[model samples]
Target: MKINGFRGRLITADHADYDTARAVWNGAVDRRPRLIARCGGSADVAAAVRFARDHDLEIAVRGGGHNVAGTAVCEDGIVIDLSAMRAVRVDPAGRTARVQGGALWGDVDHTTQAHALATTGGIVSHTGVAGLTLGGGIGFLMRAHGLTVDNLLAAEVVTAEGDVVRASADEHPDLFWALRGGGGNFGVVSSFRFALHPVGPTVLAGPIFWAADDTTEVLRFYRDFAAEAPDELGTVVRLGTVPPLPAIPAELHWRPAVAVICCYAGAVDDGERAVRALRRFGTPLVDLLAPTRYAAFQAATDDTVLHGWHYYWKSTNLAGLSDDTIAVITDHAYAARSPRSYSAMFHMGGAVARVPQDATAYAGREVAHNIIIDGVWLPAESGKHAAAETAWARRFLQALQPHRATGVYVNFLDSDDDTGRVREAYGDRTYRRLAEVKAKYDPDNAFHHNKNIGPG
Candidate 1:
């Protein structure tokens, strides 16, 4: 391996720490990179890119290293570790924040909250800003504001030629447009400038749980209710086993239940009124909804799951959840191998749909629901559970055939899954445009860890 005179630590396969460094969030993926460059700054990232290009090595970029497909690390190539470059700067007057590529959502949230501002981010605070935003972030604020990519004002990217350039509406506009919803295909983003919104130090949010037997009815009502819900009200309907938390009764622990996790991004009184109908709609087993800090709501479920757990997730966009789709979801929910596994459906046609299809690379403009079948299991039983989850997800997706969108969300993709599905993620026109951008910025496809669009 060639060694450049860079300041960052370089770990080879021979190093004891190399194995630990290459391991990704998904325990299922076990890749060994030839060298791991622990980057300290943009200069270090540039050097790594240059070295990889010159030596003809495949490169993987690691931010928070939380990619579900374990794309953050690669096999027999160079891994550029950005964990050491985390830094967040907030400009309250400008209502914008500039974040380093390595920074996690937690880091951005904490820094921006100091000024009573926030950018759209993922549900999990542990998710890296770079990967999530680039892949079109959808979260609690999505209804009130928009996807994180929609909030992105500008970015500093390191191209294949090892030159850093700014991409935005006015500068490198085509690259900017492609970067909005395009995965890491265009270039390596070093820093991102995102427009922030006045979210709360406090907001109304929590989960309402119903019995397993009520799954069908709850889903039916939720589908109708969410469609007409105000943009201020964002919700996700989850069917999974009730975890053994203090709030859940002992008898209910480890048993199946249907839950609606709601977040209201408005005044306390208004939120209460907006969610009152849901409280009255069903005889809930538990109602944990109340006023809490926005950050707290975002971080509420963060600790419930651990890293390195086996995960298999499949998703599809829906015009609306039909009766047949609901039936399939309920059936699969009951058949899920692990208590931790779940079938979730989120309403997706508010702020996200407002944008024109050609405004960005994300093509699911008219999609009403975002359905996901997630299987999480212990390493020992992963094989069986993975098979079950894959079968269930495919079955449910096929059942929703009538309401299906042309594509899938890139963020929830599985590495070994269909390349054709990746094409579906971006419609034909967008895919061609993205390919052109890929050629311009990365002709050799150096950054292929994400949902990639090959060079033109």
Candidate 2:
């Protein structure tokens, strides 16, 4: 159990914190690893990679451990837990942030916002920067600043063979290309340097909710509004119940409703003008949109999708939000079995679509929206409720199959999703290209724990 030169906390089965070490963010995942290496930095990560390879143990790289698939901790394998390595250094003069792979979106935002600089990050502040970026991150800033992957300037990685290297446009360029959207199939990224832009200390943003019965009309309006909205106007449509919070009317607590979560990264005056039509939309149960601190709003709704929840998700890249597609989504939302379960549609386009289709490993540039059918519940309702939850997510996906775009986001893939689904995440050509890069960097497929692009 001794890992030579591994200068980090190594937790074994007998370790006092073994149970805690193996636990990831998803309550549905109950994996027991033979070794949990709490990496201190790149050297520790390299040592763990070498140890895992020498022992023929599967390697699960854990950043934020928020991956719904629970691939962050493998049963009877080695987990390269990077949670302790969170360190963010901002270069305000250069407009860049060099962050450790373990850092969460909140860490990056906290540091970068001090200098009034930011980059695209996942909706939840607790989500890992590495996993989200590697799989083509979609977030509030995406419409204006592009995806997190698009902002990724460089990465420091530990290869499958235990070699430390840097990947960027000028060094290990091929590996850098794959790192953008190729997931974790190639290497374990120890750190990332991202291109940052002037964001805000505060921006106009929040949620507006309507009764579930008005979802149809809301969808139609959103489809048109989103299509024409300026790049600064980013939006997310959610069909779910209102959380029982004081900000909302007490009577509306836990009531089925549809919401438009809006963030405008522009002048407050212009943003006011931009969202005026939406503010006037059919009788809303509540309208909370207002000028808010950017970093604060990023985690505002985290309570709804908290850690340790029993999470199962099925997602797709939609070709467009046509009337038929909206109908299918509304039907599933109404028929959803669990009150905790809901459907979400993320608006895609603007800076994300402007990127060339073949520019990075991410190939969903033309997709107008990314939809997810999320099945969530508490552990107390876990055992028998799994079947119904699983069925609902699967059936929801099947209903949207015909309207799906060319590729699904790899980050959204579930733990049991098959290799065919992985291929679908990347088109045949991009997947093949990624495999070539995989073969060059990780010929043995040591990092197959992710949405893998197997080495050819």
Candidate 3:
């Protein structure tokens, strides 16, 4: 608390906000940091890092606190909390935005939408920008623009030695490359500079759902249509019960279904035409596809996956949806212990697939989709409910393993994941390169709390 050069508030066990400060997005993670350093800027972050090193205390860096893995908080370490620094500055002229470490996708979307400029971000608006970008962020705009890291111009990082440095294409190029999809093993990202693209004030976006019996037909159509769909049209398939929302038909609320969530980043009229075939393909239970404010559409699923829920997630990359794979997922989709839980598949192509695999540490550039099975349960529905709910996700993932590609998405993994899972995220080549970068920056492994890539 008395460390010099650290000009930020520190919360201890006895502090009034200690309990709230330690909470993460996943209610399952209950950790108590010995000290929570509410960082105001890079200086505070650096000082906190140095203070932890000097005291032989472990360090956990908190940025948006939405990793679900709960690496944001440590059992008895120092948490360099960046929640207080949620400033976003947009440069419309340069087509870029500078975001603080703790800023969420909603913060970025709201600011960038004001200029009709945006970047690829998380599907869930409240997801952390830092964590998502580092793990190759994918969303509705990914096919149109690219992964969040593809647009990442630079980052200001606080290294293990407490040095503040900038990583970019021209400066610390290797570090910049690693930060793109290497997860947060390097350091605490104080701020990020991202290249933005012209998106929309209004875009054609929403979900179209079909009845449970139509899962096979809808999924096959989704696979075919997505494969040939234009880059401007982004698509995702969710096989689960419908979320109860105002925009949805009350008659179809909580009904088991297969749905296509669409987003077109171009002119609304063009978007309408682009997805007309999909909208008319089936006897839909509910079709909410229409022109919507871009930022609002980005947050469409916010309530369904709200914070403070006990969350379990497992996911993998795939070349495409095989019939066997489809059958396996559909069989388990509606059987989730929690009605709110779902199995999801995100279409990956366009700008995402065009990038070379070796271009960045992100390993899934060649894959066609990313499949995620999420088990969600509320606090009151935890205990035995949590175990049963998570078992569903685990089994769902296992059943589809034979159909999955070589690697997993590092971002989807939780704290309990073994080192093999981390290695599986990036293959031998990328993993070795990341380990070398980690050795040069954080040999002592002070930042090992995350989905770690250790020192070589």
Candidate 4:
């Protein structure tokens, strides 16, 4: 079990930390890898990859280990854990951040905020930058900036062939293109260089909620308003039972509600003007919209969405929020198997659509809403409610099929068996190109743990 040229901790099943090391974000996944290489840097990562290949071991790469599908851990294989390699170097003059692959959104946010700079990142602070960026990241900055992939300037990757290489617009441009939205099928990215924008230490952001009974009117207003809203105003509508948090009014706890979480990534004056209309609409049960620190706003939902939750998420690109689509969503939201489960409708028209469809590996550029159905249940009661939650999500997705676009977000897909779904995520032409890229980079499909595009 010697990993030649390796200079990192190697853990086997007998190791004291084996059980803890194997745990990922999804509580439902309980895998025990034959070996876990706690990679320290690019050299450790390269050595681990080579070890996995030479030993005929299936490879699983772990960054922040936040993938809902639990692709970061594998049973009876080699796990290249990059958790130890988190280093964020921000070049204030260049307005860019060179981040190690294992860094999370929180890590990047903390560093970039010191210079009053930022980039598109996941809503949850703990979500991995690498996975989310590779899978086409969507976040509060999406409207103002773009997907995380769009902000990505360059990457240093260790290919499946065990070679270290750099991919960027000026060097290995095709590989760079693939790295943007293509999943980890090509190689193990050791670090990323992201082009940062002048965002804020503070911005106007938070949630405005109405009773579920007001879903129809609230949605209608949102449909028309968000479509034409300024790029700086990023809004997302969530339909779910309110969690019993201290922030919520005591009476409103566990109540069914339709909420619009808004983040205006611009001047306080402009942001106030932008969100004024949304704030005025409908009889809101709760309106927490206010000027807040960008870092605080980004990590606001961290408490509710902590790790080790059983999550089954299904997503589709919506043509638009038509009347029928709204009705279907409302009905399913009310019938959710668990109160923790909810549906999210992200308003994605501004900067996201400005990028052409073929500019990167990401699909569904022109779509209006990114619809995600999150089916969640406590792992402690998984035996009692897991099946019901998953079934509910599937049925809800099926109900929305008529209103769904042909493409879906690959990262949001949960079912591991659905290879056809992966193809649908990218259309025939793009998928074919991805396959060709796979052939050039990883013909053996060494990195098939994600939504794979095998060499055809």
Candidate 5:
């Protein structure tokens, strides 16, 4: 199963670094690929794809290798590694940027910040731009701008047939729409061009924390505040333990806390005034909000969580958080096993909701809040934490039954979750259209590592 002339590094199981190469972000996933192709460029990617198809080998495409499910590495087949192609090109005048498949959000941020601009990106800097955008990215700028996919202008993809082609609104438009939020089901995206917005050379943004006992008051206040927040301001409320840090008081370390992390993308004075209302409403344990560089704000939590930690995350869309829903969240908030585990709800309606549902593959725009339950634990405690997290999330979902959206966020899906639920994430018509597109572009279903819809 070797292509002697292919211009890339082909590593077999016998390779010296095969064990190291096969590892992914989450230590929970352990897959061993028979062969790994360290793709150098589009040509190398195409060759690897063809070789895998010819040999009937399962195929996996790894960008930054950050997928929580480890879809980036196959169990017994070929992996097309794109880590070498981390180039980013920013066009300041055009307010756009072209990012390579393997580039992380940090790469995009660094490149765009040089121009005092940014695209919609994930909250975490280490998350790969490719997967996040492909899965309908939600982040600080989402309310102000839109999903990361909404900012996407074009993509260079290597399809199932080993063809390198461009997808945009005017060219291969169906493929373009699917690529926007369809995950990696149709092809491997080699590069993406995205429209950028002015975020900040310096902006008002940071985390404001309150004690766990204040969760109810803080959440209720946040619900109202976020509902009326100006489009320029985006906030995510997280319930978790305060990390043991020098900045945090010793008495509060490891204690439960409610945090409202705010980002204001408008004028400094306007941001100050808007955030002031939040600061004054609660008796905060820590108020870290102030004027800061957008980059600094983006990277603030970068050190808290590292790769290889066991992570179980589930996400759902809510029309609005009702009283029952808040109670469910509050009950589970106190039962979290790992101090690092948390539940977060992001206000998702603004410029994002204004976009028509039929405009792209992303169909959850009508949802008001994006809720995620993250269970982060050490390797030894994974089994113990998994069941509780699952139960808590299930109970919470049931409580919000009437408010839940039919669609789900593909990025936050768990492995054992129901496949039927994927369709629910896209609604009926959009799911049907996505299936058709899957048939047209990926008839063989070679790219099915994500929240997949089989070829029609």
Candidate 6:
């Protein structure tokens, strides 16, 4: 098949950079695309989409390519690579930002921080703003400012049929609603306009850890503490084996611990008072909570979750953290085979829930918490430890099934099928609406690499 009219870098399998072009964040995915089009701008994106449609080729869209499931690449197909378009324009006067789809969270954060403004973004600095925001973005500022989608003002997208269009509250209203939380199933988002808020140049943030044996006490306090915690305080409870890293005290290396990672996005004086009870909760092994730059705090965990590591993630929303659920979670926390594996519970309420459930496609606004079981292991010879690490994560998820809520965060979903998991993520009503929108925008399911809602 011959193709032309592309004004971007069109790399075939024989290209020298083909191998690197096909690589994504998850080393577990090793698919090779037949062609990759490195888009330079929105017009390039539209041209690629048109060429793919003309050839009847399956399409994969790559932004920052940080998806844990590695849906950014596909086998024997065309990939619209957007990584080269990482431009960010901040409008301090309007308190908003115009971000290219390929720009990472760090790009948006750093640019907006210069203006003392920010929007909710992923904790990982390198995560793509497009993917995370489309899947209902969660981050340190979630409680204070709501999910990233909540701040989205507009988007420039290339539809499956190769039309460049804008989506917002007034234009393409249904498409706008679906874009808020519907993965990349509708089109390739070329640029995003986000409403920014006065977050911080500095905020009191960091983790407070306690010995693993104190899990029960710590969890009980966390459960109650978060129940009435102010919206400015966003917290996450993590159960994992401490890595032997320089940031950690050498003596506590490789020890088991339960920690509350805090991000207080309010006044320094108010943040200190808000987190005082948490700091004084039990004899914490270490308290690293202090005023720090928000962008710095967002990138603090970059070393641990770097690219090239094999990753499998499972998650479920919970009505709230219960005593029984905590017991089950802590029981499996100790059984993780990899030091990088962990079980995390994110406090989900405040601004996220204040928005009505049907306000957007993002379901589970009423959910009180979300548990993510992350299984990560360093690359091993012959992939010997892959089975063991994955099994541990699955078992941990199975144990929590009884306490699982009806909905799950679309961003945290790992499966790529139209199964019950996908249905549960959006619920029946929202799922139906998503299917209608999917049919309208991408009738042939050209963008089905994500947790897809079919064009029924």
As for candidate 4, its clashing pairs are none
lDDT at 207 for candidate 5?
Answer: 86
| Shift in Å, residue 287, candidate 5 | 0.6
Candidate 6 lDDT over residue span 1-456, tens digit each? 334556778888888898988999888789989899999988889889988888888898999998887888988989999999899999999998999999999999899999888999998899999899999998888998999999999999999988999999999989999999988989999999999999889989999989999998899888889998999999988899776656679898768999899999888899999999999988999898999999999998888787898888888898567899889988998787777888788998999999988888999798889988888888772266578778888888889989888888888877443145888889899999999999999999988877788997
For candidate 1, lDDT tens digit of each residue in 29-145?
889888999888778888899999899998898988988888889888889898887899999999999999999998998888888788778887888898898888888888888
What tens-digit string does per-residue lDDT give for candidate 2 at 195-310? 99888888899999999999889999998889899999999998878877667789987799999999998787889999999999999999999999899989887788888889
Q: Could you give the C-alpha RMSD of every candidate to the true structure, in order shown?
A: 1.6, 1.0, 1.0, 1.0, 1.7, 1.4
Q: Could you tell which candidate, 2 or 6, scores higher by lDDT?
A: 2
Go through the candidates in order and give each one's C-alpha lDDT: 0.83, 0.91, 0.90, 0.90, 0.84, 0.88
TM-score of each: 0.96, 0.98, 0.98, 0.98, 0.96, 0.97
Query: How well is each residue in 1-456 modelled by candidate 3, as lDDT tens digits?
Result: 576798999999999999999999998899998999999999999999999999988888889899878889999999999999889999999999999999999999999999999999998899999999999988889998999999999999999999999999999999999999998899999999999999998999999999999998888888888888999998889888999998887888889999899999999999988998999997998889999999999998999988898888888887568898778877888888788888889998899988888989999888898898888888999875788877888888888878888888899887675456999999999999999999999999889999988899
lDDT of 1 at 456: 85
Rank by lDDT, descending? 2, 3, 4, 6, 5, 1
Deviating ranges (above 4 Å) for candidate 4: none
Report clashes for each candidate as comma-separated counts.
0, 0, 0, 0, 3, 0
Off by over 4 Å in 5: 245-251, 383-395
lDDT for model 5, on a 0 to 1 scale?
A: 0.84
Clashing pairs in 3: none
Pairs in steric clash, model 1:
none
Stretch of 10 with least lDDT, candidate 2:
334-343
Tens digits of per-residue lDDT for model 4, 1-456 = 679999999999999999999999988889999999999999999999998998899999999999888999998999999998889999999999999999999999999999999999998899998899998999989988999999999999999988899999998888898988888989999999999999889888889989999999999899889877999998889889887777778999879999999888899899999888888997899998998989988888886767888888888888778999889888887787688888888888788889998989998788889788888888887987788888888888999999987799888988564556998988999899889999999989999988888987
Which ranges of candidate 6 are over 4 A from the true structure?
Answer: 1-3, 381-384, 416-419
lDDT of 4 at 347: 82
